[model samples]
Target chain A: MTEKDLIDACKRKNRQAQRLLYDRFSPVMMGVCRRYIKDPMEAEDVLVEGFFKVLTKIGMYNGDGSFEGWIRRIIINEALMHLRKNNQFKYAEEINPNLDYTEEPTVLDEIAAEEILNLLDEMPPGYRAVFNLYVVEGYKHREIADELGISINTSKSQLILAKQRMEELVKKRLGRHEI
Target chain B: MKTEKNISTLFQKGAERISVQPSGQAWQRLESRLEKEERRGRVVVMRWVASAAAMLVLVAAIWLWSASMQQHNFAILDAAPPQNLEDLENVDGCEPYCLVLKARAELPAYYANPVEKRN
Candidate 1:
Protein backbone atom coordinates (compact mmCIF):
# COMPACT_ATOMS: atom_id res chain seq x y z
CA MET A 1 0.00 0.00 0.00
CA THR A 2 1.00 3.60 -0.53
CA GLU A 3 2.32 5.54 2.49
CA LYS A 4 -0.85 7.64 2.51
CA ASP A 5 -3.06 4.56 2.44
CA LEU A 6 -1.01 2.90 5.17
CA ILE A 7 -1.36 5.96 7.36
CA ASP A 8 -5.12 6.10 6.78
CA ALA A 9 -5.47 2.42 7.64
CA CYS A 10 -3.45 2.97 10.80
CA LYS A 11 -5.74 5.87 11.68
CA ARG A 12 -8.64 3.45 11.38
CA LYS A 13 -6.75 1.03 13.70
CA ASN A 14 -6.34 -1.60 11.02
CA ARG A 15 -4.08 -4.30 12.45
CA GLN A 16 -2.51 -5.35 9.16
CA ALA A 17 -1.64 -1.80 8.24
CA GLN A 18 -0.06 -1.28 11.61
CA ARG A 19 2.07 -4.37 11.12
CA LEU A 20 3.23 -3.19 7.72
CA LEU A 21 4.16 0.18 9.17
CA TYR A 22 6.13 -1.51 11.92
CA ASP A 23 7.96 -3.72 9.42
CA ARG A 24 8.88 -0.67 7.34
CA PHE A 25 10.16 1.60 10.11
CA SER A 26 11.38 -0.61 12.98
CA PRO A 27 14.86 -1.28 11.53
CA VAL A 28 15.75 2.36 11.08
CA MET A 29 14.16 3.29 14.36
CA MET A 30 16.01 0.45 16.09
CA GLY A 31 19.28 1.76 14.71
CA VAL A 32 18.40 5.20 16.02
CA CYS A 33 17.53 3.83 19.43
CA ARG A 34 20.66 1.70 19.66
CA ARG A 35 22.88 4.75 19.24
CA TYR A 36 21.51 6.31 22.43
CA ILE A 37 20.83 3.11 24.39
CA LYS A 38 23.82 0.79 24.60
CA ASP A 39 22.11 -2.45 25.49
CA PRO A 40 20.61 -4.27 22.52
CA MET A 41 17.68 -5.56 24.58
CA GLU A 42 16.92 -2.15 26.04
CA ALA A 43 17.14 -0.57 22.64
CA GLU A 44 14.68 -3.10 21.28
CA ASP A 45 12.35 -2.37 24.18
CA VAL A 46 12.45 1.31 23.38
CA LEU A 47 11.83 0.52 19.74
CA VAL A 48 8.75 -1.51 20.57
CA GLU A 49 7.33 1.20 22.81
CA GLY A 50 8.00 3.84 20.18
CA PHE A 51 6.17 1.92 17.48
CA PHE A 52 3.27 1.26 19.83
CA LYS A 53 3.00 5.00 20.39
CA VAL A 54 3.15 5.64 16.65
CA LEU A 55 0.36 3.21 15.87
CA THR A 56 -1.84 4.45 18.70
CA LYS A 57 -1.17 8.16 18.25
CA ILE A 58 -1.25 8.09 14.46
CA GLY A 59 -4.32 10.31 14.51
CA MET A 60 -2.27 13.27 15.70
CA TYR A 61 -0.18 13.29 12.55
CA ASN A 62 -1.57 16.09 10.41
CA GLY A 63 0.55 15.25 7.34
CA ASP A 64 2.48 18.49 7.82
CA GLY A 65 5.96 16.95 7.59
CA SER A 66 7.57 13.78 6.38
CA PHE A 67 5.95 10.81 8.10
CA GLU A 68 9.30 9.17 8.70
CA GLY A 69 10.62 12.35 10.29
CA TRP A 70 7.64 12.47 12.63
CA ILE A 71 8.15 8.81 13.56
CA ARG A 72 11.86 9.41 14.09
CA ARG A 73 11.14 12.25 16.50
CA ILE A 74 8.88 10.08 18.60
CA ILE A 75 11.41 7.25 18.72
CA ILE A 76 14.19 9.65 19.63
CA ASN A 77 12.09 11.12 22.41
CA GLU A 78 11.35 7.65 23.72
CA ALA A 79 15.04 6.79 23.80
CA LEU A 80 15.79 10.04 25.61
CA MET A 81 13.05 9.30 28.10
CA HIS A 82 14.48 5.85 28.77
CA LEU A 83 17.86 7.44 29.47
CA ARG A 84 16.41 10.11 31.72
CA LYS A 85 14.28 7.66 33.68
CA ASN A 86 17.36 5.60 34.46
CA ASN A 87 19.26 8.73 35.66
CA GLN A 88 21.75 8.28 32.84
CA PHE A 89 22.00 12.03 32.37
CA LYS A 90 23.07 12.63 35.98
CA TYR A 91 26.81 12.67 35.29
CA ALA A 92 26.51 13.97 31.72
CA GLU A 93 27.22 17.52 32.81
CA GLU A 94 30.73 16.83 34.12
CA ILE A 95 33.20 18.88 32.06
CA ASN A 96 36.39 17.03 31.29
CA PRO A 97 38.74 19.87 30.51
CA ASN A 98 41.75 17.52 30.73
CA LEU A 99 40.58 15.32 27.82
CA ASP A 100 43.41 14.67 25.37
CA TYR A 101 42.89 15.68 21.75
CA THR A 102 46.40 14.74 20.57
CA GLU A 103 46.10 12.03 17.95
CA GLU A 104 47.39 11.21 14.48
CA PRO A 105 44.59 12.07 12.03
CA THR A 106 43.38 8.90 10.36
CA VAL A 107 41.16 8.24 7.34
CA LEU A 108 37.53 7.57 8.51
CA ASP A 109 35.94 6.98 5.07
CA GLU A 110 36.74 3.27 4.87
CA ILE A 111 35.09 2.40 8.20
CA ALA A 112 31.93 0.33 7.87
CA ALA A 113 28.61 1.46 9.37
CA GLU A 114 28.52 -1.47 11.84
CA GLU A 115 32.00 -0.53 13.03
CA ILE A 116 30.80 3.04 13.58
CA LEU A 117 27.92 1.77 15.71
CA ASN A 118 30.42 -0.28 17.69
CA LEU A 119 32.48 2.84 18.27
CA LEU A 120 29.40 4.64 19.55
CA ASP A 121 28.59 1.74 21.85
CA GLU A 122 32.10 1.86 23.30
CA MET A 123 31.71 5.50 24.36
CA PRO A 124 30.14 6.42 27.68
CA PRO A 125 26.34 6.86 27.69
CA GLY A 126 26.49 10.64 28.19
CA TYR A 127 29.03 11.06 25.42
CA ARG A 128 27.09 8.76 23.14
CA ALA A 129 23.85 10.69 23.68
CA VAL A 130 25.53 14.04 23.08
CA PHE A 131 27.42 12.76 20.07
CA ASN A 132 24.37 11.17 18.47
CA LEU A 133 22.31 14.27 19.12
CA TYR A 134 24.87 16.80 17.92
CA VAL A 135 26.50 14.81 15.12
CA VAL A 136 24.04 12.31 13.69
CA GLU A 137 20.76 14.09 14.48
CA GLY A 138 21.96 17.58 13.45
CA TYR A 139 20.62 19.14 16.66
CA LYS A 140 22.09 22.43 17.81
CA HIS A 141 24.03 22.59 21.05
CA ARG A 142 21.24 24.63 22.60
CA GLU A 143 18.66 22.09 21.53
CA ILE A 144 20.79 19.21 22.77
CA ALA A 145 21.25 20.98 26.09
CA ASP A 146 17.52 21.45 26.45
CA GLU A 147 16.72 17.89 25.39
CA LEU A 148 19.27 16.35 27.75
CA GLY A 149 18.81 19.02 30.45
CA ILE A 150 22.41 20.12 30.36
CA SER A 151 24.00 23.50 29.70
CA ILE A 152 25.27 24.47 26.25
CA ASN A 153 28.89 24.29 27.39
CA THR A 154 28.33 20.81 28.72
CA SER A 155 26.83 19.80 25.40
CA LYS A 156 29.84 21.22 23.55
CA SER A 157 32.32 19.57 25.89
CA GLN A 158 30.50 16.26 25.67
CA LEU A 159 30.61 16.43 21.90
CA ILE A 160 34.38 17.05 21.96
CA LEU A 161 34.92 14.15 24.36
CA ALA A 162 32.73 11.91 22.25
CA LYS A 163 34.60 12.83 19.06
CA GLN A 164 37.99 12.20 20.62
CA ARG A 165 36.79 8.87 21.94
CA MET A 166 35.32 7.89 18.55
CA GLU A 167 38.59 8.77 16.83
CA GLU A 168 40.54 6.64 19.26
CA LEU A 169 38.14 3.77 18.66
CA VAL A 170 38.40 4.14 14.92
CA LYS A 171 42.19 4.15 15.11
CA LYS A 172 42.16 1.04 17.27
CA ARG A 173 39.84 -0.70 14.80
CA LEU A 174 42.06 0.29 11.84
CA GLY A 175 45.15 -1.00 13.63
CA ARG A 176 43.43 -4.30 14.26
CA HIS A 177 42.38 -4.54 10.61
CA GLU A 178 45.95 -3.76 9.47
CA ILE A 179 47.36 -6.53 11.67
CA MET B 1 44.04 13.88 8.10
CA LYS B 2 40.28 14.17 8.14
CA THR B 3 38.77 17.45 9.36
CA GLU B 4 36.28 17.57 12.26
CA LYS B 5 33.55 18.25 9.70
CA ASN B 6 34.57 15.11 7.86
CA ILE B 7 34.22 12.97 10.99
CA SER B 8 30.77 14.43 11.65
CA THR B 9 29.71 13.79 8.07
CA LEU B 10 31.01 10.24 8.24
CA PHE B 11 29.08 9.46 11.41
CA GLN B 12 25.91 11.02 10.02
CA LYS B 13 26.15 9.13 6.80
CA GLY B 14 26.90 5.91 8.63
CA ALA B 15 23.88 6.40 10.87
CA GLU B 16 21.66 7.06 7.89
CA ARG B 17 22.86 3.92 6.19
CA ILE B 18 22.52 1.74 9.28
CA SER B 19 19.42 -0.42 9.68
CA VAL B 20 19.38 -3.57 11.81
CA GLN B 21 16.50 -6.02 11.62
CA PRO B 22 14.90 -6.35 15.01
CA SER B 23 14.42 -9.74 16.69
CA GLY B 24 11.70 -11.89 15.20
CA GLN B 25 9.52 -11.60 18.31
CA ALA B 26 9.50 -7.80 18.32
CA TRP B 27 6.26 -7.54 16.37
CA GLN B 28 4.52 -10.10 18.56
CA ARG B 29 5.43 -8.25 21.74
CA LEU B 30 4.17 -4.95 20.32
CA GLU B 31 0.96 -6.53 19.09
CA SER B 32 0.20 -7.94 22.53
CA ARG B 33 0.89 -4.58 24.16
CA LEU B 34 -1.46 -2.85 21.77
CA GLU B 35 -4.18 -5.35 22.54
CA LYS B 36 -3.65 -4.87 26.27
CA GLU B 37 -3.90 -1.11 25.86
CA GLU B 38 -7.06 -1.49 23.79
CA ARG B 39 -8.58 -3.66 26.52
CA ARG B 40 -7.59 -1.12 29.17
CA GLY B 41 -9.20 1.66 27.15
CA ARG B 42 -12.44 -0.27 26.85
CA VAL B 43 -12.49 -0.85 30.61
CA VAL B 44 -12.00 2.85 31.26
CA VAL B 45 -14.91 3.77 29.00
CA MET B 46 -17.12 1.20 30.68
CA ARG B 47 -16.23 2.57 34.11
CA TRP B 48 -17.15 6.07 33.00
CA VAL B 49 -20.47 4.89 31.59
CA ALA B 50 -21.27 2.99 34.80
CA SER B 51 -20.46 6.04 36.93
CA ALA B 52 -22.77 8.22 34.84
CA ALA B 53 -25.62 5.72 35.08
CA ALA B 54 -25.18 5.51 38.85
CA MET B 55 -25.26 9.28 39.14
CA LEU B 56 -28.46 9.42 37.07
CA VAL B 57 -30.10 6.80 39.29
CA LEU B 58 -29.06 8.66 42.45
CA VAL B 59 -30.46 11.95 41.10
CA ALA B 60 -33.77 10.30 40.10
CA ALA B 61 -34.12 8.70 43.53
CA ILE B 62 -33.49 12.01 45.27
CA TRP B 63 -36.06 13.73 43.05
CA LEU B 64 -38.67 11.05 43.72
CA TRP B 65 -38.09 11.14 47.48
CA SER B 66 -38.40 14.91 47.64
CA ALA B 67 -41.55 14.85 45.45
CA SER B 68 -43.18 12.21 47.66
CA MET B 69 -42.37 14.18 50.80
CA GLN B 70 -43.95 17.31 49.31
CA GLN B 71 -47.10 15.38 48.40
CA HIS B 72 -47.37 13.90 51.93
CA ASN B 73 -46.95 17.35 53.48
CA PHE B 74 -49.71 18.81 51.32
CA ALA B 75 -52.08 15.92 52.19
CA ILE B 76 -51.53 16.46 55.91
CA LEU B 77 -52.14 20.18 55.55
CA ASP B 78 -55.39 19.59 53.63
CA ALA B 79 -56.81 17.01 56.12
CA ALA B 80 -56.05 19.06 59.27
CA PRO B 81 -58.65 21.56 60.68
CA PRO B 82 -58.10 25.29 60.28
CA GLN B 83 -55.61 26.77 62.78
CA ASN B 84 -57.23 28.46 65.85
CA LEU B 85 -56.01 31.61 67.66
CA GLU B 86 -55.00 29.48 70.69
CA ASP B 87 -52.90 27.12 68.57
CA LEU B 88 -51.22 30.09 66.81
CA GLU B 89 -50.54 31.83 70.14
CA ASN B 90 -49.11 28.64 71.70
CA VAL B 91 -46.78 28.08 68.71
CA ASP B 92 -44.01 30.38 69.99
CA GLY B 93 -44.00 28.93 73.54
CA CYS B 94 -44.50 25.26 72.51
CA GLU B 95 -43.87 24.75 68.86
CA PRO B 96 -43.74 20.93 69.00
CA TYR B 97 -46.96 20.75 71.07
CA CYS B 98 -48.69 23.02 68.60
CA LEU B 99 -47.58 20.75 65.76
CA VAL B 100 -48.90 17.71 67.66
CA LEU B 101 -52.22 19.52 68.26
CA LYS B 102 -52.39 20.29 64.55
CA ALA B 103 -51.93 16.60 63.79
CA ARG B 104 -54.49 15.57 66.48
CA ALA B 105 -57.07 17.83 64.84
CA GLU B 106 -57.08 15.47 61.86
CA LEU B 107 -58.54 12.60 64.00
CA PRO B 108 -62.20 11.42 63.67
CA ALA B 109 -64.93 13.67 65.10
CA TYR B 110 -65.61 11.34 68.04
CA TYR B 111 -61.99 11.63 69.06
CA ALA B 112 -61.57 15.27 67.98
CA ASN B 113 -61.26 17.35 71.19
CA PRO B 114 -60.28 15.17 74.14
CA VAL B 115 -61.65 17.66 76.74
CA GLU B 116 -65.01 18.33 75.01
CA LYS B 117 -65.46 14.79 73.74
CA ARG B 118 -65.07 13.32 77.22
CA ASN B 119 -67.60 15.76 78.67
Candidate 2:
Protein backbone atom coordinates (compact mmCIF):
# COMPACT_ATOMS: atom_id res chain seq x y z
CA MET A 1 0.00 0.00 0.00
CA THR A 2 1.05 3.57 -0.59
CA GLU A 3 2.28 5.62 2.42
CA LYS A 4 -0.72 7.91 2.01
CA ASP A 5 -3.04 4.90 2.13
CA LEU A 6 -1.27 3.58 5.23
CA ILE A 7 -1.52 6.98 6.94
CA ASP A 8 -5.23 7.19 6.13
CA ALA A 9 -5.84 3.78 7.66
CA CYS A 10 -3.88 4.79 10.72
CA LYS A 11 -6.02 7.90 11.06
CA ARG A 12 -9.01 5.56 11.06
CA LYS A 13 -7.32 3.72 13.97
CA ASN A 14 -6.75 0.48 12.14
CA ARG A 15 -4.45 -1.84 14.10
CA GLN A 16 -2.90 -3.42 11.00
CA ALA A 17 -1.97 -0.02 9.62
CA GLN A 18 -0.49 0.98 12.96
CA ARG A 19 1.67 -2.13 13.08
CA LEU A 20 2.82 -1.59 9.51
CA LEU A 21 3.85 1.96 10.37
CA TYR A 22 5.77 0.79 13.43
CA ASP A 23 7.59 -1.97 11.53
CA ARG A 24 8.54 0.48 8.81
CA PHE A 25 9.91 3.31 11.00
CA SER A 26 11.05 1.68 14.26
CA PRO A 27 14.61 0.86 13.15
CA VAL A 28 15.57 4.35 12.03
CA MET A 29 13.70 5.97 14.92
CA MET A 30 15.44 3.58 17.31
CA GLY A 31 18.78 4.76 16.00
CA VAL A 32 17.67 8.33 16.58
CA CYS A 33 16.70 7.47 20.16
CA ARG A 34 19.99 5.68 20.86
CA ARG A 35 21.95 8.76 19.86
CA TYR A 36 20.45 10.62 22.85
CA ILE A 37 19.66 7.95 25.45
CA LYS A 38 22.51 5.77 26.83
CA ASP A 39 20.79 2.61 28.08
CA PRO A 40 19.44 0.13 25.58
CA MET A 41 16.27 -0.51 27.58
CA GLU A 42 15.64 3.21 28.04
CA ALA A 43 16.41 3.80 24.40
CA GLU A 44 13.85 1.16 23.49
CA ASP A 45 11.37 2.81 25.80
CA VAL A 46 11.98 6.14 24.11
CA LEU A 47 11.59 4.55 20.70
CA VAL A 48 8.27 2.97 21.62
CA GLU A 49 7.04 6.12 23.31
CA GLY A 50 8.12 8.22 20.34
CA PHE A 51 6.43 5.92 17.87
CA PHE A 52 3.28 5.92 19.97
CA LYS A 53 3.26 9.71 19.78
CA VAL A 54 3.69 9.57 16.02
CA LEU A 55 0.72 7.27 15.66
CA THR A 56 -1.47 9.32 17.97
CA LYS A 57 -0.61 12.60 16.25
CA ILE A 58 -0.64 11.26 12.72
CA GLY A 59 -3.76 13.24 11.95
CA MET A 60 -1.76 16.44 12.40
CA TYR A 61 0.52 15.62 9.49
CA ASN A 62 -0.67 17.80 6.57
CA GLY A 63 1.84 16.66 3.92
CA ASP A 64 3.81 19.88 4.45
CA GLY A 65 7.11 17.95 4.21
CA SER A 66 8.37 14.37 4.15
CA PHE A 67 6.54 12.03 6.50
CA GLU A 68 9.83 10.57 7.71
CA GLY A 69 11.10 14.03 8.60
CA TRP A 70 7.97 14.72 10.59
CA ILE A 71 8.31 11.43 12.45
CA ARG A 72 12.03 12.07 13.06
CA ARG A 73 11.29 15.44 14.64
CA ILE A 74 8.81 13.83 17.04
CA ILE A 75 11.28 11.10 18.05
CA ILE A 76 14.12 13.58 18.55
CA ASN A 77 11.88 15.81 20.64
CA GLU A 78 10.89 12.81 22.75
CA ALA A 79 14.55 11.95 23.35
CA LEU A 80 15.30 15.51 24.40
CA MET A 81 12.30 15.45 26.75
CA HIS A 82 13.61 12.22 28.30
CA LEU A 83 16.99 13.81 28.84
CA ARG A 84 15.42 16.91 30.36
CA LYS A 85 13.38 14.72 32.72
CA ASN A 86 16.62 13.19 33.96
CA ASN A 87 18.11 16.63 34.78
CA GLN A 88 20.82 16.29 32.15
CA PHE A 89 20.96 20.01 31.46
CA LYS A 90 21.44 20.99 35.11
CA TYR A 91 25.12 20.01 34.90
CA ALA A 92 25.80 21.97 31.71
CA GLU A 93 28.58 24.53 32.39
CA GLU A 94 30.41 27.20 30.46
CA ILE A 95 33.79 26.17 29.07
CA ASN A 96 36.89 28.30 29.61
CA PRO A 97 37.42 30.56 26.60
CA ASN A 98 41.17 30.06 26.63
CA LEU A 99 40.96 26.25 26.55
CA ASP A 100 42.78 24.82 23.54
CA TYR A 101 43.72 21.35 22.21
CA THR A 102 47.01 21.92 20.29
CA GLU A 103 48.02 18.23 20.16
CA GLU A 104 47.90 16.30 16.89
CA PRO A 105 44.18 15.45 16.35
CA THR A 106 43.12 11.84 15.93
CA VAL A 107 41.49 10.90 12.65
CA LEU A 108 37.85 9.84 13.06
CA ASP A 109 37.89 7.28 10.19
CA GLU A 110 40.24 5.09 12.24
CA ILE A 111 37.56 4.57 14.93
CA ALA A 112 34.66 2.18 14.46
CA ALA A 113 31.08 3.27 15.18
CA GLU A 114 31.03 1.01 18.24
CA GLU A 115 34.19 2.66 19.43
CA ILE A 116 32.58 6.05 18.89
CA LEU A 117 29.51 5.10 20.95
CA ASN A 118 31.77 3.68 23.67
CA LEU A 119 33.69 6.95 23.71
CA LEU A 120 30.42 8.85 23.89
CA ASP A 121 29.32 6.69 26.79
CA GLU A 122 32.32 7.82 28.85
CA MET A 123 31.41 11.51 28.56
CA PRO A 124 29.13 13.46 30.92
CA PRO A 125 25.40 13.49 30.14
CA GLY A 126 25.20 17.26 29.54
CA TYR A 127 28.21 17.41 27.24
CA ARG A 128 27.01 14.37 25.28
CA ALA A 129 23.54 15.90 24.84
CA VAL A 130 24.92 19.23 23.66
CA PHE A 131 27.28 17.47 21.27
CA ASN A 132 24.47 15.31 19.89
CA LEU A 133 22.24 18.36 19.46
CA TYR A 134 24.83 20.67 17.98
CA VAL A 135 26.97 18.33 15.85
CA VAL A 136 24.65 15.48 14.92
CA GLU A 137 21.27 17.22 14.92
CA GLY A 138 22.67 20.45 13.43
CA TYR A 139 20.95 22.70 15.95
CA LYS A 140 22.29 26.21 16.38
CA HIS A 141 23.48 27.29 19.82
CA ARG A 142 20.35 29.42 20.24
CA GLU A 143 18.07 26.52 19.41
CA ILE A 144 20.03 24.17 21.67
CA ALA A 145 19.87 26.70 24.47
CA ASP A 146 16.11 27.08 24.01
CA GLU A 147 15.49 23.33 23.88
CA LEU A 148 17.78 22.43 26.82
CA GLY A 149 16.84 25.56 28.83
CA ILE A 150 20.49 26.59 28.98
CA SER A 151 22.26 29.79 28.03
CA ILE A 152 23.72 30.11 24.53
CA ASN A 153 27.16 30.37 26.06
CA THR A 154 26.59 27.17 28.03
CA SER A 155 25.55 25.35 24.87
CA LYS A 156 28.69 26.46 23.06
CA SER A 157 30.84 25.50 26.00
CA GLN A 158 29.23 22.07 26.27
CA LEU A 159 29.94 21.33 22.59
CA ILE A 160 33.60 22.38 22.99
CA LEU A 161 34.03 20.23 26.09
CA ALA A 162 32.28 17.25 24.49
CA LYS A 163 34.50 17.42 21.40
CA GLN A 164 37.63 17.86 23.55
CA ARG A 165 36.71 14.87 25.71
CA MET A 166 35.93 12.71 22.67
CA GLU A 167 39.33 13.61 21.18
CA GLU A 168 41.03 12.59 24.43
CA LEU A 169 39.19 9.26 24.44
CA VAL A 170 40.12 8.73 20.77
CA LYS A 171 43.82 9.46 21.47
CA LYS A 172 43.90 7.03 24.40
CA ARG A 173 42.24 4.36 22.30
CA LEU A 174 44.74 4.90 19.49
CA GLY A 175 47.70 4.71 21.94
CA ARG A 176 46.44 1.45 23.39
CA HIS A 177 45.89 0.05 19.91
CA GLU A 178 49.43 1.11 18.87
CA ILE A 179 50.94 -0.53 21.94
CA MET B 1 39.82 21.41 13.23
CA LYS B 2 39.49 18.98 10.30
CA THR B 3 39.20 16.19 12.88
CA GLU B 4 36.30 18.04 14.51
CA LYS B 5 34.39 18.03 11.24
CA ASN B 6 35.38 14.40 10.69
CA ILE B 7 34.14 13.45 14.14
CA SER B 8 30.73 14.90 13.22
CA THR B 9 30.87 13.07 9.89
CA LEU B 10 31.67 9.84 11.69
CA PHE B 11 28.65 10.14 13.98
CA GLN B 12 26.34 11.22 11.15
CA LYS B 13 27.51 8.29 9.04
CA GLY B 14 27.09 5.90 11.95
CA ALA B 15 23.63 7.29 12.73
CA GLU B 16 22.61 6.48 9.17
CA ARG B 17 23.62 2.80 9.44
CA ILE B 18 22.87 2.02 13.11
CA SER B 19 19.52 0.34 13.81
CA VAL B 20 19.03 -1.59 17.02
CA GLN B 21 15.93 -3.75 16.91
CA PRO B 22 13.51 -2.90 19.73
CA SER B 23 12.33 -5.68 22.04
CA GLY B 24 9.09 -7.52 21.38
CA GLN B 25 7.46 -6.08 24.47
CA ALA B 26 7.86 -2.54 23.17
CA TRP B 27 4.84 -2.73 20.84
CA GLN B 28 2.74 -4.30 23.55
CA ARG B 29 3.50 -1.45 25.93
CA LEU B 30 2.75 1.17 23.29
CA GLU B 31 -0.49 -0.50 22.27
CA SER B 32 -1.63 -0.62 25.88
CA ARG B 33 -0.93 3.10 26.37
CA LEU B 34 -2.75 4.04 23.19
CA GLU B 35 -5.76 1.99 24.24
CA LYS B 36 -5.79 3.71 27.60
CA GLU B 37 -5.74 7.16 26.00
CA GLU B 38 -8.51 6.20 23.60
CA ARG B 39 -10.65 4.91 26.46
CA ARG B 40 -10.04 8.10 28.41
CA GLY B 41 -11.06 10.23 25.46
CA ARG B 42 -14.26 8.21 25.03
CA VAL B 43 -15.09 8.60 28.71
CA VAL B 44 -14.71 12.37 28.46
CA VAL B 45 -17.07 12.48 25.47
CA MET B 46 -19.62 10.26 27.22
CA ARG B 47 -19.52 12.44 30.32
CA TRP B 48 -20.22 15.55 28.27
CA VAL B 49 -23.16 13.90 26.52
CA ALA B 50 -24.66 12.77 29.81
CA SER B 51 -24.30 16.24 31.32
CA ALA B 52 -26.01 17.85 28.34
CA ALA B 53 -28.89 15.36 28.50
CA ALA B 54 -29.39 16.05 32.19
CA MET B 55 -29.41 19.80 31.57
CA LEU B 56 -32.02 19.39 28.82
CA VAL B 57 -34.25 17.31 31.09
CA LEU B 58 -34.00 19.88 33.87
CA VAL B 59 -34.91 22.73 31.53
CA ALA B 60 -37.92 20.83 30.15
CA ALA B 61 -39.16 19.99 33.65
CA ILE B 62 -38.92 23.63 34.69
CA TRP B 63 -40.83 24.71 31.57
CA LEU B 64 -43.61 22.18 32.22
CA TRP B 65 -43.87 23.25 35.87
CA SER B 66 -44.14 26.93 34.99
CA ALA B 67 -46.83 26.23 32.32
CA SER B 68 -48.90 24.19 34.83
CA MET B 69 -48.63 26.95 37.41
CA GLN B 70 -49.92 29.52 34.91
CA GLN B 71 -52.89 27.22 34.04
CA HIS B 72 -53.75 26.82 37.77
CA ASN B 73 -53.73 30.64 38.19
CA PHE B 74 -56.22 30.96 35.32
CA ALA B 75 -58.53 28.34 36.93
CA ILE B 76 -58.56 30.25 40.21
CA LEU B 77 -59.44 33.48 38.38
CA ASP B 78 -62.32 31.73 36.55
CA ALA B 79 -63.83 30.44 39.83
CA ALA B 80 -63.54 33.72 41.76
CA PRO B 81 -66.52 36.07 42.57
CA PRO B 82 -66.85 39.11 40.31
CA GLN B 83 -65.09 42.22 41.66
CA ASN B 84 -67.35 44.81 39.93
CA LEU B 85 -70.66 45.04 41.91
CA GLU B 86 -71.81 47.77 39.46
CA ASP B 87 -72.63 45.01 36.98
CA LEU B 88 -75.68 44.07 39.13
CA GLU B 89 -77.03 47.68 39.12
CA ASN B 90 -78.92 47.14 35.85
CA VAL B 91 -80.89 44.04 37.08
CA ASP B 92 -84.69 44.18 36.55
CA GLY B 93 -86.87 44.99 39.64
CA CYS B 94 -83.95 45.21 42.05
CA GLU B 95 -84.46 48.48 44.00
CA PRO B 96 -81.77 50.37 45.95
CA TYR B 97 -83.12 48.83 49.25
CA CYS B 98 -83.08 45.32 47.75
CA LEU B 99 -79.59 45.84 46.53
CA VAL B 100 -78.53 47.11 49.99
CA LEU B 101 -80.12 44.07 51.69
CA LYS B 102 -78.51 41.66 49.26
CA ALA B 103 -75.13 43.31 49.75
CA ARG B 104 -75.37 43.32 53.63
CA ALA B 105 -76.99 39.83 54.05
CA GLU B 106 -79.15 41.26 56.88
CA LEU B 107 -82.54 41.10 55.06
CA PRO B 108 -85.25 38.97 56.86
CA ALA B 109 -86.62 35.79 55.30
CA TYR B 110 -89.95 37.54 54.38
CA TYR B 111 -87.90 40.15 52.43
CA ALA B 112 -85.74 37.55 50.72
CA ASN B 113 -87.66 38.20 47.46
CA PRO B 114 -87.22 41.97 47.40
CA VAL B 115 -88.39 42.00 43.78
CA GLU B 116 -91.76 40.49 44.91
CA LYS B 117 -92.16 43.30 47.57
CA ARG B 118 -91.46 45.83 44.78
CA ASN B 119 -94.34 44.22 42.77
lDDT of all predictions, in order shown?
Answer: 0.83, 0.78
What DockQ values do the models have? 0.26, 0.24
* Model 1 residue B3 distance off true place after TM-score fit, in angstroms: 12
Q: Give the residue spans of candidate 2 off by over 4 A.
A: A90-93, A96-113, A174-179, B1-5, B67-119
The lowest-lDDT stretch of 10 consecutive residues in candidate 2 chain A is A101-110
lDDT of 2 at B33: 88
Error of 2 at A126 (Å): 1.3
True contacts kept of 2: 0.38
In candidate 2 chain B, what residue range of length 10 has the lowest lDDT sum? B1-10
Q: Write the per-residue lDDT of candidate 1 for residues A15-83, one digit (tens) a residue.
A: 999999999999999989988898999999999999999999999999999999999999999999999
Off by over 4 Å in 1: A90-105, A176-179, B1-5, B54-119
lDDT of 2 by residue, A1-179 (tens): 99999999999999899999999889878877877788989889888889889999999998899999899889988989998888776654566745774534445445565666677777777888888877777889999989888778777777877787877776777553321
Q: What shift in Å separates residue A155 of candidate 1 from its native position after superposition?
A: 0.2
Q: State TM-scores per candidate.
A: 0.73, 0.75
